[model samples]
Each structure stands twice: as structure tokens, then as C-alpha cells.
Target chain A: MYQALFFLFAASAVGFAINLLIQRHPIHSALSLIGVMGSLASLYLMLGAEFLAVVQVIVYAGAVMVLFVFVIMLLNADKEEPSDRSKMAKYLGLPLLFLLLAMITVVIYRQFPEDAMVQFGDFPGQTAAIGRLLFRDFLLPFEVISILILIAIIGAIVLAKKEP
Target chain B: MPPAVILFTLVKILLLLVVLLTAVAYAVLFERKVVARMQSRWGPTRVGPHGLLQPLADAVKLLTKEDITPSSAFRFIYTMAPLLSLVFALLAFAVIPFGPPLTLGGVDAFQVADPDIGLLFLFAVSSMGVYGITLAGWSSNSKYSLLGSLRSTAQMISYELAVGLSVIGVLLMTGSLSLRTIVDAQAGTYWGFLPRWHVFPQIVGFFCFYVGAIAETNRLPFDMPEAETELVAGYHTEYSSMKFAMFFMAEYANMVAVSCVATVLFFGGWHGPLFGPPSLQVVLPLFWFALKVFCFLFVYVWLRGTLPRFRYDQLMAFGWKFLMPVALGNVILTSFVIVAWPALSRFWS
Candidate 1:
């Protein structure tokens, strides 16, 4: 069941992304982007990252998407004419996408050992275990990442706001 | 390898999925009713016995409604966005420990999948929900939708830090990442009366989490994404019918997810007073869990009534400057206290 779900998610992600690239309208492309995020979140679940999955949906789908929609409306990007994909660009892009997909498939097929299937077990205290790891072992890096995020927040504000 | 075990687990998964989907349906009704009361009117009374059947009606309406795809829009992406949102929302509930594992027909039954990295899985899936809104807004090719998506993204990213940090205190006290273990760790009491709920030791963490959760859900005060006066329905402006309903469903599901996490971390999930009876031990824990979750849900509703919408800048500033720093400081203080007092660690153990 898990394996089937994983493959379904990956296939949906790749298919929707390809569709997104081929779509003429920006709106359609944006919607396809959502499909990509969803598939990724599902993949995370298959990898045993429950908290990451929730965070992915809440932060990425719920909040970030809202912002994307806001910007789409603010810019009135929907009314703009859909630009046709140039033949030259398509020639260059198609191979790149195929190469990326092939690489991903190879990596998955190679890295994941068949015998490495995760067995369900006692999961009590998993959050606490993560907490200990984050605070004790990964404390310095975690703090640094947070600071970097803070900087990003500031940068976003500066970029979004109108200059005085 | 037992056939019975496999059958039982499959049944359990199906059952839980039904319950969760049902809960998602009712949560929407609950929100509408509560919001109506706040606005000085009875909500959904005409549906079924004070609108009890309103969700079913709404679902039918949505399913039957016209599903329009914009001519210029990205058809594949636009269709996929809502499905992605709904899928991730459903996924987050898989690891949530609804009640203690119960024995059914000689088999031990628990919630859905219980992966070792359950909490992280929830976080990752929840974060992925952003893509749905972003895609919806962008694919709609509408300015209003884009602006809404942008606000939602910024808000979620900013508050997620505080939300993650707030749970550190509970993690420190419990020393387990598993939802079941966290509840088990808090099963008893300290000083005979004070239950070992993390809320006492991690009050600051709780406050930060509470605020961040509200932002994460795009509830009042942090609902810049759907600021009707300004953004005009935000990211889902261009979405109609079932596609729009999917986003609605995701919001309520996310709310429940956060509430469950808060219950486990700070409210001593499924842990209540033991009356020294064996039967009570089995039933009371589930009751406690339900009570805690209900209280959090009530608080969610209450906040909607009590607080006004926050200015976008103020919301961003508060999340980054106030909540983040406080959460960080609390973590430091907790670590210091744990290290300084060996007795405290011993007491928890």
C-alpha cells in the first residue's frame, strides 16, 4: 500500500509539472505548481516525516498560496495574453525536464534498498526524540537557520513594501 | 503475517478515515454557526435540526455546482491544486493519536499509521498546503488571488518558526517524539494535584504556540489572506464550487491538526485523573483527550469573536520579533532549568 501510494504521488507530481510547463496560461501553471507541492508532501509522509507533512500543507498550501493569489490579483496577471512557448525554448526545456526525471528515477531505484522497507513499530515519544535531536545535537545549525529565516522575512518585507 | 491482523488494520484505517472526513464536514458547519452567532444571527438552522445536516447539503451543492475551468487558465494545475490541498490535509491526521490503543476482537487497535517520525511528517504535509493556495491564486491569473496567496505564504512561514519552537519544552520534559509516548509521560501528577501537563512548565511556549497556530490557520487577527475589505476573498477568489470547498475543508482540517498537537504537547493528551479503577483507566483517558481537543476548538472559536483582524505589517512584526524571540528564550530557559536542576529531570522520570 505504501509503495503504491508513493509511486502514485511521484507520478502525479511529474505529470502535473509537465502539464504546468506546457500550459499557456499563468493561472494554469500556478495551479499545477500546487500539485507539485502536494505530491512532495505525500512523499514526505511516505518517508516518515509526519510533522513535516503538516507543515508543508499549512505553510506552503494554506498561507503561501494565499499570498500567491493575492499577488496574482494585485498584478492582474490573468488578463494578460498567454504567450506561446517558443520552439527553441521547448527544444531546450524538454530534454532538461526528461534528464531531471531520469536522474530522479535512477536515484530512487538505486538508493532505496528493497529490504529497507520500514516496519511499523512503537512510536511513543517520537516527538520528544526529535525535540532532543533538534535542541541538543542540531542546536547550533537550527539556530543559524532560524536567523537566516529571520533575515529572509526582513528581505521579503523590504522587497514588498513601497519605497519611501 | 496473520490474516486477521491485516484485515483489522485495514478496517481501522478505513474507519479513521471516515471519522476524519466526517469531522472535516462538521467543522465547517461549526465554524459557520459560530461565526453567525458572533455576527448576531443563527446560522444553518434550516438544513437539519438547527443545521446539523448542513454539511451534507453543502457537500451536495458543491458537487452539483458548475465546475468551470478558465479558458486561459492551466487546466491540469487548476484541477490538481485543490486535490493536493485536500490530500495533505487528510495526511496530517494519520499520525494523530485519537485515543489510547484499544483491544478489539483480541487485536490491538490504534489510530492510523504510526511512523517513527510522525511529528515531522505532519509538519511537512501541512507546509505543503501552501502550494495549493499559491497555485490556485497563480493559476487563476487574477490579481486578487495572487495577493491572497502571497499573504498566506508569508504569514505561514513567519509563524511556523514560533510553532515549532513552542513544542521544544514539551519535548524536553517528555523526551519522546511519539504522540502516544508524550501523553503517557504526562499520565501522572506532580505534588499530588498539579498534573504533569506541559502547560505549567511551558506557559510561554503555550502562548507562543497559541498565537502562531492562529496565524498558521489564517484565523482572525492573522487572516490577512482573506481580508475581504482589501483582498476580496484572497487566494480562492477565482475558485468556485467544489474547488473552493476543498480549500475550506483544508482550513478546518488544519485547525483540527494544530489542536491535536497542542493537546498532545501541552494539555496532557488522553491523560486524566486515575480513580484507581482498571476500567476507568481505559475509558477516562479517551475522555480527557476529547475534552482537551474540544477546549482548544472552543478557544479557536472564541478568538474569532474576541479579536479583530490584525494589520498585515503588525502581524508579521509580532510573529518574527515578539513570538520568535520569546519562544527561543523559553527554550533556552527550559534547557538551563533542566540542566541546573537534576531533581527536575528525575521528578519527570
Candidate 2:
């Protein structure tokens, strides 16, 4: 059941990511990203990261993607003009992406040579459990991240504000 | 857990969908009648007895009408918008506990899906509702639709902050994210007379929530996105027939869903005065829940009738400048009270 659910969500997530890349219109691309987020959220749920899954939907899919969609709409973003970047960028970008992916894969492989299977309900991600870990264990990082978000918000407001 | 359980759940889902759709239909009629009466006019009496059959007639008319799709519209997104709205509006009902969970024949059954993150789930789905209106407006390829949709997106997104913050007070008091648990927390009474509704202590939260919900559902005073006179029916200006009906039905469904959530969150959901036999006890709670929900729906209509709509700037200013701060303050005050309750109790004793 876990494998089936994983495959389902993973397939859709990949599909949506591809769709995001291929979509001509910015709105469609934004929607595809939202779909990817939603599928990722479901996968998170299946992995028993309930809080993370909800947060993924609320923060990423609900809030972040809405902002993306809003911007796309506000600008009335047209279809992508054919890539006008230099040949160096085109040649280097793909290989660089692949290199990055390979490095991540290698790192993950080295971290856990024998990949453990994800059994359902193996790790409970209850809100209370996550809250404890966040506040107690990852307290400094959490506070720093929150401060970073506050800074970003202030930056956005400042940037977007009228000249007056 | 078992085949019987699955069967029961399926049955329950079917039952709920039908009941909810019917309720949505009547809610429209109820709104129309109430609003008309407020304006000293009879509403839809020609359709059936006191317009009781008006929803049915309207449904038929909508179904029979031509579903117009403009040549300039984004066809795919245009088609998806109303469905998206309706689905999200209905989805929240799944987590809302209509009555107490019942245990019968060694089977536990109550709401559709009582996830631990039910409140978050509700918010997540509701937040996504913006997409429908946004898409509808953009896809319509009309200036009015574009303007309306933009206003809606901003309004809903802004007001949702207040809505989420206000709910924190109740959640802090209850210390649970589950709607069922929140209801259970507010089950009993203070002094054995007054029901322990969160509204008493979280009055500001309740006010914020009510106002936020009104705005969220895009009802009167906050219905800037669909301001008929200003935007030619707003984001749905280009839509016709069943597509238009879908948007209309979606609005009413959203109203009902928000009301249901409000009832569960603030009022003692399904927790009311009870008398008579065990059989009666089982049903009375559902009655009280429905009654509370009805009151909320009525208030929505009443507000629509009484209040004139706010300008776009006024609406945004109200949501951001006023509602947001008040909601934030309410949360802070509630949290402080909760934190200091022990010391305060010691002094009182």
C-alpha cells in the first residue's frame, strides 16, 4: 500500500514538474507547480509526516503558489519567448543540473548505502512531536528562519511600496 | 478498518453529498427570500409555494441554458474554475464533525475523515479557493472579470490571515487541531448552566472569525469580486448556464462550510441541552448543530440585505489595517490569559 501510494504521488509529482517546464503560459506553469506541491504533500502524508504534509499544503501550495499565480496574473505574463540565453548557458546549464543531481544522489547513497524501506506509520509526525523537536532541538535554526522570513516580508513591502 | 466500515463511510459520503447539495440549493432560496423581505418585496413565490421550489426551477433553467464559452477565453482554465471552487467548498465538510462520534456494533463512525490536522486541512482547502476565482477572472478574457478576480484574490488572501489568527485563540484554549476534539473541549458548561462555548472567552476571536468568514465567502459588504453593478457580475461576467450556476452554488456551499466550521470552532458544536430517551439524545445534538449552522447562514443573508458594499480600498483597508491587527491582538491577549491562568486562579481562590 505504501509503495503504491508512493509511486502514485511520485509519478504525479514528476509529471507536474515536467508540465511546469513545458507550459507556455506562466499561469499554467504556476498551476503545475501547485500540482507538484500537492502531490508532494500527499507523499509527505503517506510517509506519516502529517504536520509537514499539512504545512506543505498550507505554506507552499496555498500561500506561496497563490502569490506566484497572483504575480503571473498581475503581470499578465505572456508565453515564454524562445530561449535567448547564450550558447554557454544552454550547454553548461543542463550538464550542471545533471552534475548537481548526480552529486545529491551520490551523497544520499553514501549517507545510507542500504536504503531503508518506508513502512507505513513508521515515524509519527504529529504536531506536538514536531513542535517539541522544532522548539527544543532546532530552536536556533527555527528562530533564524523565522527572522529571515520577517526580513523577506519587509524587503518585499519596501520594494513594492509607492514612491511617496 | 473493515468492509462494513468502508461501506458505511461510502454510504455516509453519499448521504452527506446529497444533503449538502440540497442544503446549498435551499440556502440560495433562503438568502433570496430573506433579502427580498428585507427590501419589502416577495421573492420567487411564482415558482412554488412561497418559492419553496425555486431552487429546482432555477436549477432546471440553468441546466437548459446555453453554456457560453467566449472565443478569447482560456478554454482549459475557464472550464476548471467553477469545478475547483465547488470541490474546495465541499471538501471542508468532510472533516467537520456534524455530531458526536458514535460507536455502534464495535464500529467507530462520525465525520467523514477526522484527521489530526483537520483545522489545517480546512484552511489549506479554503485558501486554495482563491485559485478558482483568479482563474475564472483571468480565463474570461474580459476587463471586468480581470478587475473583479484581482480584487477577490487580494481580499480573500488578506482576510484569511485574520481568520487563521482568530482561530488560534480557540485552538490555544482547546489545544487541539481536530474539529471533533475542539467540539469535545467545549462540551460542558461553566456553573452548570452556561454552555462552555469558546465564544464567551474568545469574543474578539469570534468577531474576527465571523467578519473574516463573511469576507472569505465573498458575501455582502465583502463581495467586491462579484460587485454586479461595478464589474458586471465580477469574475463570472462571461460565464453562463450551468457554469455560472456552479459558481453560484459554490458560493452558497462555501457559506455553509464556513458556517459549519464556525459552529464547530466557537459554539459548542452538537453540544446542547438534552432531554428524553437515549434515542432522542442521539438526534438532538444533530438538531442543535443544524440550528447553529442555520443561524449563521441567516446572518449571512441578513448582512447582505442590511449592509451596502464597501469600496475596494475600504475592503482592503478593513481586512489589513483593522481586522488583521485586531485578530493578532486577540490572539496575544488570549495566549497571555492562558499562560497566566494558573496564577490568576491562585489569586482568585
Evaluate residue A103 in candidate 2 and report its C-alpha lDDT on the 0 to 100 scale: 100
Residue lDDT tens for model 2, B179-289 = 889999998899988889999999999999999999999999899999998888999999999999999989999999999999999999999999999999999999999
Here, model 1's chain A TM-score works out at 0.71
Cα lDDT tens digits for candidate 1, A68-109: 654665565643465696988778887987999999989987
lDDT of 1 by residue, B1-349 (tens): 6888789878987887787778879877887789889899998899889999999999999999997777767676778778878887788777888778787865556567566556656666666666677667667767787788778878887888888888888777776667777777877788989998889889999999989988988888789988999988998887888898989888888888889889987888887765767987887877777788878887888888788899989998999899999999999999888887988768788
Give one digit per residue, the lDDT tens place, for model 2 in A21-138. Answer: 8988889999999999999999889878888998998889888888888888899888888778798988899999999999999998788757665567757799999889999999
Ten-residue stretch with the least lDDT total in model 2 chain A: A113-122
Distance from true location, Cα of A17 in model 1, Å: 9.5
Relative to the unseen true structure, what is the C-alpha lDDT of residue A45 in candidate 2, on a scale of 0 to 100?
A: 90
Q: What DockQ does each candidate score versus the true complex, computed on alpha carbons?
A: 0.33, 0.81
**Model 2 TM:** 0.96
The lDDT of each candidate is: 0.79, 0.91
Candidate 1 lDDT:
0.79
